[model samples]
Target: MALIESQSDAIICINETLMDDELRSILEKLENEKDKEIFGLVCKRWLHLQSTERKKLAARAGPHMLSKMAARFTRLVELDLSQSTSRSFYPGVTDSDLSVIANGFKCLRVLSLHNCKGITDVGMLAIGNGLSLLQSLDVSYCRKLTDKGLSAVAEGCHDLHVLHLAGCRFVTDGSLKSLSKNCRNLEQLGLLGCSNITDIGLISLANGCQQIKFLDISKCSNVGDAGVSSISKASSSCLKTLKLLDCYKIGDESILSLATSCKDLETLIIGGCRDISDMSIKSLASECKKDLKNLRMDWCLNISDSSLSCILDQCRNLESLDIGCCEWVTDAAFQVIGTGEIGLSLKVLKVSNCPKITVTGIAILLDKCNYLEYLDVRSCPHITKGGCDEAGLQFPEYLKVNFTGNVVEPDVFL
Candidate 1:
């Protein structure tokens, strides 16, 4: 057999399993002024194929950034095109662009199109039309996506595990109901800012899904306590992490219900629920704090010393706590925390904006909570020089601190 003549660059690429498109972009970037002028004359298929596939290149490439991709990489496993700036940068490829990406990435396992404004139902349909191997999909901030698009995802992507639809306003309860019907294996579901989803949809979620481990319904304004209450009744053993921030419709009853039901929950974020008072959280602490490790009650103004007392006294396993803006909690909040054996597990504490807490308060925490690692005390305006001096007495051998929004760096205690 006669040996084939080849360019030096071509010889190296074949050994590396490199694609033609990726190689071409590098060549174009490296080519000199003279080679570019006469490079098109090198071969027939070379120049003809390059310029003719401009539309396809424009579909998945930045306008200013050179796209070398002529065909999708068949073995492509992960595709992340988050943010509208990158998606829109290429003067986005419309429906045809999506078809190209979808048809090309048939082996794609993870696809993230976070805030890709150019993608419509046309782009989503392309996924159904091609990629069946998708396991994780984040379509958060894709404002143009409608329920029709989500319906397609639910229908086609049955193996999806992680689905983030944050800020996808068009998604209604119907979309969630469909997801509950189809994606039974879903492990992580983030529906933040999905305003149309109410108890009707959430109830469907509980009925259809049994494997849910992480669920975020923050900014789901339509969801009331009744919806959460229903979830609380479900004896699902795997519900561990749940975030309900800005779920304005939920009152104290719903939170109480959830605390009662989700007994195994390790992390619970109920920030911005103005309707919740100490009574609600006290009940939660009483019921779930035994297993609770992380709790964020930030901006929960109604929480006072009694509620903090209940949590600090009962939730001994708490590793993280955010009691920001709960002004009613005075220095006395740490009184129970100083109990050597009871509150010993504290590791992370955020008491930002709690003006009532002074040096005496932090001194109790610094002395008792030996494992404290991360602390955020932004604008507590009350943590004066006296408080800093008290905090200086900390026994934190493995601690990092953020005090009053001023970085003292990670001062490890001996």
Candidate 2:
């Protein structure tokens, strides 16, 4: 009788716990999509609750199938119909499908059609006309989208805050100018791999979108220092993240001007900007390094050990740093980093192709950076496999060290 009573009490306790509103709210706020999906499968009540509470949805289903499912989620705020896998078993989402989505999800603020190769200006037009409240849209790898479709979006979604047009090669300055004029509240804009975008388009965006916070002009070869200068002047205070990767035309003069103005910057990626030297980095460190969390300077050949010193001195809160293929990075730079306050905050470090960084410097770094979670030492010929294995043993279970191609013998000792 006692055991039966105890079992009943246990069941009742679980029921009470599951019914807790606070717990349910916490579960609803989960960042990971997979975890939330799994949580939805607990029971019919959970499934229904999760389905209704979910604001964002990314399903493999096509437009026709999604339209059927859309009716179930009356509160859907975001939708992603992009191909999630490298190879899709079904046909990619199309313009007719976007029309269906436009009809169903009226409350949607964000939509992503990344790699939906079949979608063109017609789909964008449908989206523009239907989703008036849309603030964020990503059409990355939708190579067919041109100024006509983008113009439609600008006219329709006047409240747009974020827009990604990566790999949309056909989009020109006209589309940018149109969006700038219409979507004045734009905060984040990505033009990655949009090679045709020139200074005129950049200037237009800067003049109109004063609230811009995140900007990625990577691979926009025609946009030089003049373009960056214009942008810096307009969105200096609001700008938080900037990516100039493969913008080979950009040099220290433009970078310095940006760094001096945008003091609130948190993440800066200047990979392949060969013209950036220690001067630009030092300037950046002096102005924004305190607040900066992530810095990637991959393949910037001009940046030497002094640049690292400048970073370590003031950029104490930095969480992730990548200086891969910076051949000038030596033991002196690592020595400073190993002993500095960065040791406490740095979680990820990439030093690949830095041949001068020896095992001794790495050992010091390992000893100091207790919170280090990832270390990439690939192509660093000086770091032996035996040394890396020893370091791996020293590191906690959570830390991952990549020492590929350095292995000489399987059983070699340091």
Candidate 3:
């Protein structure tokens, strides 16, 4: 009976294929995987067509299954083999698996191997040699990668636009130089925790990759004012999002340059940049007021209520603000925010560790910013657990309040 059913399905698929255009239209309309799978189960012809037309795939298998996947997903353009959150006990994809992928998926544009620790320079070499048409590559946390492998990629994949090497500790200035010379079209670059990269490498990058829009160099301690100033001037028109978190060497000079040049800046994160003062903050607020939306200056010790008030007054579209650890920030800043147009658009606010901010300030912000979804007032010396619990009663059900150290978990009396 099973054999008869299979033969009947095959006959039906053959008849359906007679009208090839109609069958292709039906296949294109299927957006859900389950629907596509059911359509494929009809027969060998349907399954073959489905596989050939597929464009993206996320595989969790190892080297042994790669060849079979390559044969099946012949037209795949995006492949994600990231094992960052995987729970499987098996060893992850290695150099051999990447070689198979590079050889098979000639048309592939985006490849992500995030946290694939087993892969090393050998795998990157294979990718550079074979995947010349690649546009976006993310090897974040692949600690085994170094300058040689990344240079090969830069030289080979000239069309590369987005490259994320976050936590690639072994990568140094050499790789940045290679990228600067070859990948001129690169727009977004993430070098989070790439400690060895200094101002020299950044200068090289600024001279070449002038079209960069989004850049994250967080925790790059070697980067200083000169490097940032170069990037600001070079990519001024296109620069939008910039993160300089924990870069102690960065001071007001870098921020001033950015404020003067990058007028279209949207998101600016300088958390832990203790030297940033009201001077640069006020300049930034005045220049990029129209486009600035997300601003995080936590631990910016020099910023006072003057800067905060200036930001609230100028940056009308600001959505998320983090002033945690800004000891100089007082209730006056919240007063300005609550009474102004900024609160109408504000969504997320963090004032943790600000001893000057009390329950009154919190009340004013909550009452005015109806759209606020997340509020963090943790460790604020003036905010009491009972006061926060009472305030929580008035908070919207969707609003998340983080009162970690100051408040206990409220219970039901029923």
TM-score of 3: 0.91
Higher TM-score: candidate 1 or 3?
3
**Segments of candidate 1 deviating more than 4 angstroms:** 1-72, 84-88, 92-94, 338-343, 390-404, 408-414
How much is the lDDT of residue 70 in candidate 1? 26
Best by lDDT: 3
User: What ranges in model 2 sit over 4 Å off?
Assistant: 1-54, 60-74, 338-344, 387-396, 405-414
lDDT tens digits by residue: candidate 1, 1-414: 112336663433231454567636644674464564354455544454344322211124542221234242334577666655543565443556567666665667787777677779888887776777788988888888887888787788899888999888888888878888988888898888888889998888777766788888998988997777666565357778888987877778976886767777888888888888989888888888778888888778788999999899888898888888888989876788756356458777888788888777777777778788877777888675456865675546466666645655332110
* Overall lDDT per candidate, in order of appearance: 0.73, 0.83, 0.87
Better of 1 and 2 by lDDT: 2
Model 2 is weakest, by summed lDDT over 10 consecutive residues, at: 405-414
Best-to-worst order by lDDT is 3, 2, 1
lDDT of 3 by residue, 1-414 (tens): 013235446533345335656667789999898898888888777787788778899988766688888898888999999985556335788898989998988989999999888889999999999999999999999999999999999998999999999999999989989999999999999999999999999999998999999999999999999999999999999999999989999999999998999999999999999988999999999999999988999999999999998898778888888898999989888667656534457777888899999988888887777788878888898886688677674778878788885443222100
TM-score of each: 0.76, 0.82, 0.91
- TM-score, candidate number 2: 0.82
Clashing pairs in 3: none
